[model samples]
Target: MTSAPALEQPVSTAESAEPELPTPVVAPESLSVKFNDVGRAFGGRTVLRNVTMTVNPGEVVAILGASGCGKSTLLRAVGGLDVGFTGELLIGDRAVSRYDERTAVGFQEPRLLPWRSIRRNIELGLPRDLEKSAGKARVDELLDLVGLSDRAHLRPREISGGMAQRASLARALARQPGVLLLDEPFGALDALTRLKMQDLLMDVHASTGTTVLLVTHDVNEAMQLADRILLLGCPDSDPAEGATVKSLVTVPGTRPRNRASQDLARLGSQLYAGLGVDSH
Candidate 1:
């Protein structure tokens, strides 16, 4: 099987060079994810239970919860990485088992190959069927989009962490997947870098109109990035019973939202309370 891109680098790059190509346009309704009564268990120990949610096409949804509340498990289920869950998980009209090319996942790490240049790493995510020349152009376009055009020839070890993560995002987009699954993709960055990445993500989302499913622990991150937030809470305070969707909070207003506004602060407070956190 072809290896998935590493977490430390972005996606893989093209093997040969070609002229630059225009960015591809993705159909707006190509990808929509839905979960129905989904549940998972290990050795009869439930991890997630009766969790149901829907991510509309072109929408950005954030999954927020305390650690070990199965946020990652839920994401994995959507990405087709974890198939042990029960009930239904669908990407568009087909089951996730159908493995549609319109979906891609990004992890916390860039996962770039050390030997490959930045450009090459991003190229790895391109469809294998793309023409060599077209692949090169696509890579160039992504590098520019991620603000790494000048650094394309550099190896992974040569760039900063923020740059690497940006490359990782580009790699995921390289496949031009309509649904982008991100699991704490900016969790490890410095505060400033993390905030910058968030803005960059918003820009990318606006341009591509890709549906996003983000799993994050940062309340502000969710408020800043997601149009809707899913709070998974532990019912009866029992792990064995598993965590389920506690609340779905919708953020009001337009893109480029003001994180410092009272509206977001109020929403953040609610999210924190749901997670059993005291912002006081």
Candidate 2:
């Protein structure tokens, strides 16, 4: 894993302050998320079963698992993007509604409109009720935060892949989401760009303090970004019961954790093991 610079220092108050989005010059509130015996099935086949876990306010939780283990399904359940699940899923004490306003989702694809300017695409996600002037300021703040201010006026096709993803992230932030759900947002990026995106995500998380639920296949990425790692899998390598929580690990240390730390390396090996990959 490539280590990002400035991973050993805490973000200062001024640097970490939330942007003028969400509320005019006010920071958005981070919300808690809960899954109570959540289970999802497509007809007769169960993909996720008994997924019960809580993501605390302002904390980042990363989900990892085998292929077809329902990682994306779990994330979509929280986003209210998929309604086929059983049991209760809540965000900030309210049962999740279809396309809940309290959350925003970022998929593996940037999904930006080809015709719209990057700024325009991001503006599309602003709350409908926000005043015109406030919305502009919010979008401006987001642009600066995501380092897309220079490319704000450019179309999605003009910028690099990383820049497009940043625009996507900014759009998601424009919703002022209390809970941000990401399904492998960086999985499509190349190795170096992905590392850079990981660092950028940490910076954004530090600044916004929004509760984040990230579904990723990379153990190192999880260790780098998540406060806790939530591993889902079918027990004993059997696929009959569906995937459920197999390990919930609390990563040690503070934000901007050292990527080269022995603690993290050891923990990474353990996580890979839990996923049925042996460290040679």
Candidate 3:
């Protein structure tokens, strides 16, 4: 039998160095929220200080790190939940003084009203000018988007955890907020359910293109979801010297990711390294 020629292997040399790959570029604009030398204190205890960073419009920024890293506190400050801080906090070219409906926070829990049906919960974000039919239509559409259209008439207590969270997301979107803040929204769910919710969140982002800022202790979760990961370490020795932006790592992986894949593993390792943690 005649032998076929073997394929030649490329030689590795100093010239090869590291192969450069194209990176996705996002345009820079005025900060959605800018914290300049911002500091916060409470009862002689400081939770954050000199923490500065800009949240871009239509950007998905995930804050990830250990507990007590002040990630949640920073989110609260930007959302105008914490007014004890001193510094500049600009939200879409405007200073944040009072909490505006334009910024909506979706917490770990669904927090839906049991007395009201899923439709009512979703319509809560609509304005008074929205007529009953319009509001109902919006609700029905959101329910369809969340894959819970048939459950619109069901109460919060009647739905599953995943379904409830889907309803919560629909309600949050119904407001048409420019900025959406999520604080470990899937933290309370089981591993499988959490994964499902993560996919759903990504789907929503793909369709709505809403600016999302999520806070989570799970490094892998941050790597899988955020376009940019913002690490906030714990406050320093002095209360005045509070938590700051440890690092901002850009995640350039494709969506609908496989958590077990090597790319995700490398990304998680990088995130851990950003937190000053040694990973195996």
Off by over 4 Å in 2: 1-26
TM-scores of the candidates in the order shown: 0.89, 0.90, 0.82
Put down candidate 3 lDDT per residue, 1-280, tens digits, no spaces: 5754543223456676443521111111213766788877778677677777887777889988778768888788777777777788878888876665567778789999999999889888675676888777777767877889899899999989989888888887776667788888898888998988888888777666668899998887887888888888764455355677778878866676676888778878887876768898
Mind giving the per-residue lDDT tens digits that candidate 2 earns over 54-133? 99999999999988899999999999999999999989999999999999998889999999999999998898999999
C-alpha lDDT (0 to 100) for residue 104 of candidate 2: 93
How high is the CA lDDT of each candidate model?
Answer: 0.86, 0.90, 0.77
lDDT of 2 at 155: 100
Residue 44's C-alpha lDDT in candidate 3?
Answer: 68
**CA lDDT, candidate 1, residue 155:** 97
1 or 2: which has the higher lDDT? 2
Q: Which has the greatest TM-score?
A: 2
The candidate, 1 or 3, that scores higher on TM-score is: 1
Candidate 1 residue 55 Cα shift, in angstroms, is 0.9
TM-score of 2: 0.90
